[model samples]
Target: MQQTVVEHMDRVAEDVVALTLRATAGDLAPWDPGAHIDLSLPNWLDRQYSLCGDPAERDAYRVAVRYDPLSRGGSEYVHRFLRPGRALGVSLPRNHFPLVPAPRYLFLAGGIGITPLLPMMRAAAAAGAPATLVYVGPSPATMPFADDLLRSYGDRVRIVETGRHGRPDLHALAATLPADALVYCCGPATMLAAAEAAFPAERLHAERFQPVARTFGPDTAFEAVCARSGDTVTVPADESLLDALALSGRPLPAGCREGICGSCEITVLDGTPEHRDDIGAPEGRMFPCVSRAVSPRLVLDL
Candidate 1:
C-alpha cells in the first residue's frame, strides 16, 4: 500500500481544479475502466479517486481529484494543500464499475465524472473500437481536459457547453448513437436518472460519484446471513446492511459507501435485494452499502 509520488500536475479550470498524481507502481495492481484507488492522507482521512490514465502502464497510476464547493476537507486539501512528489500510501485498485466489451461504446460525462471515463475513452480509441464521447459542462473553458479530448478524438467527441446554451437534450443523446451500442454515463443524480429513464437497461452502464439519497418510506427491518462466515446479522431500520456488517467487524473493501462505488458489492444468494446503485448490469445482485433487503430474510454470498 506504500507508494511514492512521481508526477503531480494541476489542471485548473474556472470552476474546478484537478490534481493529477503519478505514483510509483511497484506494488500497484492493474486496473480496468471504472476502477479506483483509495488514498490515505496524513490526517487519517482516506478518499477514493478513479484512474484516468492508461491501465496497462504498470510503472505508474494516474488519478485526478477535483475541488468541490460542497466538499468536506478532502477536496479542499487536495486543491489547496497537497503537493507533488510526496510519498503516500494508497490501496490497490478496486473496481466495481467495469467497462463492458461491446462493438461500440457511447460515453456521456458531466463535470468531474469525466475523470473515470477519460481512460476508458482512450483505451477504446487505442483498440480501434468505435466510440463517441458526449461531454456536457458549464462551458468549454470550465470543462476539464476539454481541448485535449477534442484534439485527440476530434469529430467523434462532442462537447456541450451548457453555460452558453442549455441542458443537452436527452432525446438527442438517445438519437445520436446506434441501438447496439453500450452507453456509459457518470454525472449528477438527475442526469443519470434521466439516462436510465431514456435508455434501456441492457444498453446502459452508469456510476454515481455521489450517494443515492434514499427516502425510507416506513420503518423496515431485515436479517442478513453472510455465506462465507456463516454469521447472522440484523439490519436495523436506521442502519444500512453495510454499516451493520462493518459494525459487526467485517472489513468490507468499499468506496463511496453511498452505493455508488461497486466496491462493497456481494452476490445475493436468496431474498429480493432492493437495488440502490446504478453501476454495471443490475442482474439483481446487492450492494450492501446502500441497498437493503426488501424481503424479510436475505442470504448473501459474502
Candidate 2:
C-alpha cells in the first residue's frame, strides 16, 4: 500500500469528483490505461476506481468517484468526507482490462464507465490508430468529463444522451464495425451484453463495475485441497469457497468477494471449475469468491 494525500479535487460533472493523489514520500508508481487502485477508506471500506489520468504523469494518480446513494460506503466516504490534503491508503495499480494493440479501436462507455476508456482513446489517437468513442449517459451534465472529451476528440467522439434519445443502437453500430476493429466496452451490464452479442470473443474486450447475476448450477458439498498446506476444506452449498478456505486456516489473498475483482483467483491444480466468475480468466484459474468445483474434490495452489 502507498501512503498518499489528496492533492486536488474538482467536480468534473454532477455528483462526480476527480481526485489527484500524490504520494507522501516518493513518486507514485506508473499505471497504464484500464488499471484501477484499491482504495482503503475508513471503517475497512475498500473500493476500486479506475485510473483516469495520463500515464506519463508519474507524480500523481487521478481517479474519479461518482456519489452513489447505494454505495457500500466507499463513494459515500469519498464524496462526503474526503478533501484535498486528506491522507489515504491506496494499493498499487492492478489491471484486468488492458488495451491490446490493434489496427482500429471502438470504445463504448456508459455513464461513469468512461473513466477507464478516456486514457485508452487518447493513446489510440496519439498512436494514429483509427479510434472512435461512443459515450452514453443520462445527459451531458451527468457524464463525467463529457465536455472535455467532446472538445478534445470532436468528430471522433459521439455522445448519446439516453434521457433525450433513449439508448442508442450501440449494437447496430458495433455490428457494422470492420473486422479488424477491436471493440472495448466498459459499461452497465446491458450495454456489455449487447456488445458481447455483436462482437466475436477474440475481438471484443470489456470491464464490468458490477457482477452479473451470480447464478450457478445446484451447488453441492465439495472438498478443496490446498496444495501448499495440504489442507482439505469442505465447502458447503451455502458458503463460498473462499470463506471455506479462510475458516479452515488456509486463507488466500482476496478482495471484492463477489468475483468481479479477480482478487481471490487461485490456480486449479486438479478438477474442473464451474467457471462462473466474470473476469474471464482462462481455464485452470478460478476465483474462489463465487466459483465452485465440478468434481467432488478439487485441488488448488493456494
Candidate 3:
C-alpha cells in the first residue's frame, strides 16, 4: 500500500465528491481505463473505488465517490469525514473489466457506474474506434461530468435524465446496435438484466457492483492443500475458506469478503471449484473468500 494525500476535493454532483490524490513520496501506480484501487481509510475501513482520471498522469489520480445512505460505512465516512490533505492508503491498481479489441463498441453507463467507463470512452475516441456512450442518471444535477460529455463528444454521446422522462430502454438500445458491436455496460441490476436478455452472452460484457444470484450445492468439509509448502488445512462447511487459511498461518490478501472483489483469488492446481464470485473467474482460479472446492481434496498453488 502507498500513502497518498487528498490533494483536492470538489463537489462534482449532488451527494458526490471527486477526490484528487497524490502520492506522498513519488508517483502513483499506472492504471488502465477500467482499473480500480483499494482505498484504505482510518477507523479500520477499506473500500474499492474506480480510477477515473487521465491514465498517463502518474503524479496524481482521481476517484469520484457517491454518498450511499445504505453504505456499509465506507462511502458515508468518505463523504462525512474525509478532507483535503488527509492521508489515504491505496493498493496497486487492478483491472477485471478490461476492454477487449472489437470492430465497434457501445458503452452503457448508469449513475455512479460511469466512473470506470469515463476513461474508456476517452480512450476509445482517441483510438479512432467507432463507439457510442449512452449515459443515464437520475437527473443532470446528480450526474458527474454530464455537461462535459455533451459538449465534448457531441452526437456520439447520449444523456438521458430520468427525471425528465422514462429511463432508457436498454432492450431497445441493444436491438439497434450493429451485429458485431461489443456492448460494455456498468449499471444497476435492472439495466444489466435488460441488456443481458437482449444481447448474446459473447457480445455483451458487464461489470457488476453486486453479486448476481447463484445456486450451489451444500457446503461440506474440504481440504486445501498448499502445493508449494505441502501444508494442508481443512475448511469447515460453515466457515469461509479465507478465514480457515488465516488460522492455518497462510492468510491471503482479501477485499470485500462477500466475493464481489477479486482480491482473495488463488489458483487451483488440481480440483473442481464451485465458483461463486461476481467476476466470472476462468477455470483454475477461485476466490477463497466465498468459493469452495467441489472435490473432496483440493490442491492450491499457494
The clash count for each model shown is 0, 0, 0
lDDT per model, in order? 0.78, 0.88, 0.88
Instruction: State which candidate, 1 or 3, has the greater TM-score.
Output: 3
Q: What TM-score does candidate 3 get on C-alpha atoms?
A: 0.96
lDDT of 1 by residue, 41-73 (tens): 766667888888778877677777777888776
Candidate 1 Cα outliers beyond 4 Å, as residue runs: 2-6, 20-27, 212-217, 222-234, 266-275, 280-285, 294-302
As for TM-score, the candidate ahead, 2 or 3, is 3
Return the lDDT, model 2, position 293: 82
lDDT of 2 by residue, 116-149 (tens): 9999999999999999999999999999998899
Query: Which candidate, 1 or 2, would have the higher lDDT against the true structure?
Result: 2
Error of 3 at 217 (Å): 1.1
Q: Please, what is the TM-score per model?
A: 0.82, 0.92, 0.96
Q: Which candidate achieves the best TM-score against the true structure?
A: 3
What C-alpha lDDT, on a 0 to 100 scale, does residue 223 get in candidate 2?
A: 93
Q: What is the Cα-based lDDT of residue 266 in candidate 3?
A: 89
